[model samples]
Target chain A: MDTEPALFSILRQGQVLVASVHTALDDSQLLRLQRDLVGRVGTDRARGIIIDVAALDVLDSFGSKTLRDIAEIARLRGALTVIVGIQPDVAQAMVELGIGTGAVATALDLEEGMAHLAAALGPAWTP
Target chain B: MPGLTYDAGVGAAVVDSGADGPPEPSAAELHLLVTRVVRARVGNHPAAEDLVQETVARVLAASDRIDGGIEAYAVTTARNVIATMWRDEARFQRYQPRMVDLDEPDAPDMGVLAGEDQVAVRRALESLSVQERSLLLAHEVDGTSLATLAAREGTTAGALGAQLRRLRARMRAEYLIVASHREPPTERCRPVLVAVALRDQRRWREAGVDDHLAGCDFCADVAGPLLESSQQDSGRVAIDVAKDHDVVEARVAVRRLAADLGFDRSDVTLVATVVSEIARNIVKFAERGRMTFEPARSRPGIRIVARDRGPGIEDVELAMRDGYTTYGGLGLGLPGARRIMDEFDIESVPGRGTTITMTRYRKDTR
Candidate 1:
């Protein structure tokens, strides 16, 4: 049994919702997080979603797919999702594996991810 | 009824399991017990240890009954377990005639209604048809030969023999369900437990077993510790790949190992990515497999081996081409691993499994 600590914490920053992932999550947990983030997008009227993956050590196909799904689903709910903080090695490996960030934007860290979110949210947003 | 009675068979199982199991069977005492009862009956079948562990699990499950003393009850349970294996082999596999029918003199109806949890056994018996129950009793208890029973029923002995074997198999299957103390949520639970008992991960994954095992607590309790054993050597590390988390763990561990072997930071990621891809392939296609890293036998390098008994590739050539996706993967797993590693070799049989061996040597610095 893994620790009962939350897999990822979702923070509401003005019109943006930022999900800071604390650790690597399994397939089912990733799906749950995806659903939760998508649900919160509509409920909170979030304009953008920033999923921070800096703490994750490995980004496999399933992990990449989950990020893509989260971004795509959040987009359908009228929010943009930016995955941030994929490590250099993991990114290189992802490139080797031919896994591109499919339409979902990426940035170096949480700050950059927040910037992407802010840009998507645009002029009137103050955060 | 009011006083305490000793059941040594149950005690033997607990004592035999030993020191949280040091990855080896305890001593020759129980080994010889299993050999004498199981080996002597089946003549050194490969699954002898399985029969022994199965009997142990049954003893733990049936902990209550005050059967024959210590050795006496164990001997009976061992025989029953062997009988189940023997009949299973005879029925499902190609029928090989062992000398039991012709040579043995009036065999001791091995575990029909004897040496099992009586309550569970009776409930299993209740699930059988009246005719089947009567046939079981007449043949097992009364020592009535199948020929005589066939004559009485006006059917050929061969047909009745098939029926009797099917009936017994059904009874054993039902008894296992009853003895385990809970109904399995899915039918795959039996094969999954059999895989756990045999520690065969390939069979464990063929029937949505990973999901089933993850969800079923009772089945997990029965099999968790047994299936978790792995060999650890100072020269190498062996990791069992079953899921996403295992792949991550393999990557992290292999990265450290490669770094320790003087691989540069970039190569460290390469080795880790190779571990990542191969282990992930196992989780996706094989459902379960093993990834092992050993010190190179004949070179100044490291040896990485990933083996899985899953549906192997039909055309290795086509699979090696770039951007060829199968099994919902990104399709670069095999090709990408081949590109980054110094030596890559993949051997696979269509229905059997796949074995990929990759070796990376530290660059010579003059």
Candidate 2:
């Protein structure tokens, strides 16, 4: 309830949709984003999804679960999901979560996330 | 013991003379009220009847002998009688002669003294062996007959009396040691002090202490309120966990605190993640709880404590094992926490609450 809806802005760039999370989201807001992102990956024919979490101070269990769920659902729609900008500490914490990012692709930042997305799209893919 | 003396005629005067002296309750009502008050205090005490009679006698006698009217005077007399009864009952139980100070042996009252004597006495008592403690207390404090105790133990009275005398001597030596506040004479005290300085009580026995810290000032100090102030460098941070956003806040705060406490970048994240998972668990399962972390005293690390009054886990050991998630699939919060923390402890009472205490030491790096 404390989180504003869609506080993180999403933008389209070619076949990749980049969603930069700028603030914290409560449970329902996170659920809403998961639904919206997975829907767009199909309807918009997006080949990849890049999620930048540089501004997020935490990626808690629920947050991590949402990321995993988004990735899983987006993959079913023929889109690849790449999480980016996980801080050094956040990365260490995710390792301790014992799931190792739950099979979701990760990158150091937005550039790396875009690079990973392009590479996962295969040899013929362009930026 | 009051200064006023009762005239035996005052008992006769109190009969039904409602004609005078502040007729608010009338003589019969006043008499009934006084009797009821006395009965409430000394309830079924065999001396209750005599106490009531004496109270009435004092009230009426005070009227002529003292300043106040009988109505107002009667209340004081009744209250004093109740207080005196309790005091006498207490005194009767002890059955000891009046106290005398060591310095002024002639004086009856011991007067007010400091807690040093009490602390010393407690420490000395603590120093005694279990058998000596019970035996000494049985004879001296509990008033159990020493001869009867000797008979029960199949020992002679003279032997028991001699053992009791040695027990007192050992207690006196311990009292002197405690009173002086000097370093304990034994070689073992150093390692115990060193372990305590490390701000970890778990290492107490491991630090070369097989025995003999009983009644030592250091032992009492360890058992005192010393654990709380251990983390004095960065102090402590406490946050309430109630919602998803609160977990985020807790993570950020814990991250900062870990950094402040000299945790490396990766370790900071580990601590922060620990906070995040635990706080989220509080929001998701417990509904509400509190999380606290602090510098490990002046040590190079932090300590964390999370407490929740909720539906506690029925099986704590099962909860700690891998693959035990209240939520289905890939839940590793608690188990992962146990893995990363240097020290982890969890106490839970089913249907009551849960408290998890954990600590992580920092690794030194440039």
Candidate 3:
């Protein structure tokens, strides 16, 4: 009788898609995110993806790796991707575990991440 | 002693208390009950039986104040005593390095400098310059700070770090080359070889050793023990968890154990990561805990037990939820650990503590 809530909520701002993740995703959720992103990017033709992860309490190795892969795949599709809002404890654990989010651009929060995208994309960019 | 073993009869008789004006449970009854509780909580621990004995003594000492039934009182007392034991063990494990089973051929054999290995190391070290050899020995064997050594040598810490990193890599490479060929290295090379051998044992940190080894194929060939030639069973590894470093140590021990049990590279990493998550929780929440790795009794697998006396989980079902965190922590730890491991069990009592048991079977081996 009850259905699970969506794991991520996407809002398109001009040429960018700001996907705010609301839960810790498992393998199936990750696949869903990937599929949704592909469908959205195909229709909207977004040039930038900002993944907001402020609600995420933990980013285990698998989750971290998946995010990085998502960023890589987005780049291949001509979209710049940035991750924002890593909690302090999660960051500490990731460093100690030697689980680096390799080559993934990161920002302190959604605002800063948008700033980064706007600056990188130049004056023609709109958020 | 023979009569005391009849705890079941005593318990049964006590059930009909109204018929005899509620006779109190005897010391033997309390002892048996407390022993069962302690043993169930601290399975396979050498101190479990001793802890039960101590609990019974403590309960009897305060027998007068027990308002509730003696069985309930004894169980509560036993739980408190176990918490204190876990706290003490955590403090002790923090100061002491864990003992690992490196004697097995498949163990993480940090090459010992003995016999032919010693001879090769000696020859290798002698090849290095006097200054280089002393620096290696002072840092690796003597346990001197690189900063102090650098001050004496008139170099900055950054420069010294770089120099030592390069020096260690070169020495290890030379030692491995000489060691593989069965040739006694020149005198200039002896001390360097000994330094490499010592670093291999993890007696002290060798700057950039892992990085250098990763890039160098020759050193990789000769660096690790030729354990593939000798098949041996891995004995039990016990890691005391008190801090983040201890968590890392526990993970390394698990990885080695998985390797010893012939798990593939990715499986080894998965097992190690699971250990890391569980051990981290122990340190983060409990400030101390213990992890033990041994052969599972029911199957061909490595069984791991993680026990902590931190504030217990109030809602295990909710905690099992992936994003649930009562302390604003990454809720991913418990759920993530469960996903990685083949088997996971968690037990927690509010105001008491928590224990997690997990096992990863060598399915291929079985």
Candidate 4:
């Protein structure tokens, strides 16, 4: 078995939240994490979620699609989604794969991603 | 004397005013003129407004310098200003979006299934005797043909075939029983492990496996998820060789992957030959370019994407033609790459970039 580390950390400030995914988040892991987060924060309270993946070196079609699905699920649960730390090569690969990054708000880095998430959550909720 | 002096000064100041005051530019005429200037300066309208404003400002400032018709002067000034703006803006925009930091999100790990479900699959497999496991593993994972397996095990093909049939029946019965009581095994749950096993065994040849899979729906179902999982996990491997063309290194890597995938030696040779040609091109023309290997989405094939940001091919169609080379010696870079692979795609934007994708399918080992 491939023993690659798959870790995720969740940070919450009031209603706003940020999830730092620090591994190769495969399809299976993403679904589990999404389910767990939805359960813990109560679909309504999970206002904003930011996936920080600065460490990942690869992002394939399955990976890109999972991000879109996460965004859709988060939206349904009254939360906004933003993805940060997408490497340029991976972005190019995603483009070549013809996968759309439209559903998830993508940022150059985590700080910008957090800012986008905060803004999406509105002025009332500061993070 | 005072009246004559005043008349002389007035006559000196009277410049030849020529034609009736420059034809008044109508609003439509002004808009059309501005639009043309804007388009010329900025390729698109999104940035045209700013260019138009700058043009108007320049025209107003140089009003005194205008010798001829005001409209002509305005148009001339607009074009000059637009040209200057385009040059400056192009440079600025180029500097703003650096190549670094366009990071995308990591692949999400969708919760495939619980650990218990995986345990259930293993337990079900283990329920069979060691011989049964070995037979199934050889047939399903290694993708060894019944004839080959029979030969290896010193048995007849008919006996080996019956063995596979019995093993499949046993596995299906066990899986059904597990599914009835336990969490339904996800499509991904069992196949992922099986794929891992196959990859580990280096049995990627689809030929022997393909034959068995053709008639066996159960085995296909079992292998499908594992194959997908393996592809997802393999990701992409990129090699950057500075000055030397690492043909040997690339060939070795390709061979290793091909061996694991169970590709026929001949097919591997064809792919390796194409890769060598592509590598030569990079060395000869590009000087430096990265060669990448990744799993293809369709079938048990691998994709090789070669990319270079060098002086692109002058004519892609001509370049694809066999023996069409600017710098001699059996020019088969494009055509050869096309001939060996199941699918070949090439995209090149002159002076910008070139990307070539080649896919080689694994021989089904049934």
User: Which candidate ranks first by TM-score, i.e. highest?
Assistant: 1
Give all TM-scores, in the order shown: 0.51, 0.50, 0.32, 0.31
lDDT of 1 by residue, A13-45 (tens): 888898988876666567778878988998999
Model 3: residue A31 alpha-carbon error in angstroms: 30
Error of 1 at B276 (Å): 2.2
Residue-level lDDT tens digits of model 4 in B1-366? 001011222222223343565444433354467668677656685768776766655654554566546567767777877778668878988987784687765545433455556766887899889988988998899898898988889999999887676566556546544654644244433333332334532433333332233223354455544445455566644444234326445655665676667766556555655665676676667665667676667788788877776677889999988657777434556776776577899888787657787888786821
Ranking the candidates on TM-score from highest down gives 1, 2, 3, 4
Q: Which ten contiguous residues of candidate 4 chain B have the minimum total lDDT?
A: B1-10
The residue ranges of model 2 lying beyond 4 angstroms of the native Cα positions read A1-5, A24-29, A122-127, B1-234
Model 4: reference contacts kept, as a fraction = 0.00
- Against the true structure, whose lDDT is highest? 1
How many Å off is the CA of B20 in candidate 1?
A: 90
- Chain B TM-score, model 3, reads 0.36
Better of 1 and 4 by TM-score: 1
Runs in model 1 with CA error above 4 Å? A1-5, B1-233, B298-300, B363-366
Better of 2 and 4 by lDDT: 2
Error of 2 at B179 (Å): 45
Q: Candidate 3: deviation at residue B86, Å?
A: 77
Q: Is candidate 2 or candidate 4 better by DockQ?
A: 2
Docking level for model 3: incorrect
Give the number of the best model, judged by DockQ.
2
lDDT of 3 by residue, B185-258 (tens): 23423333334444342421243233233223343356444211211333666566776557667877777777
Candidate 3 Cα errors over 4 Å, as ranges: A1-127, B1-234
By DockQ: ranked, best first: 2, 1, 3, 4
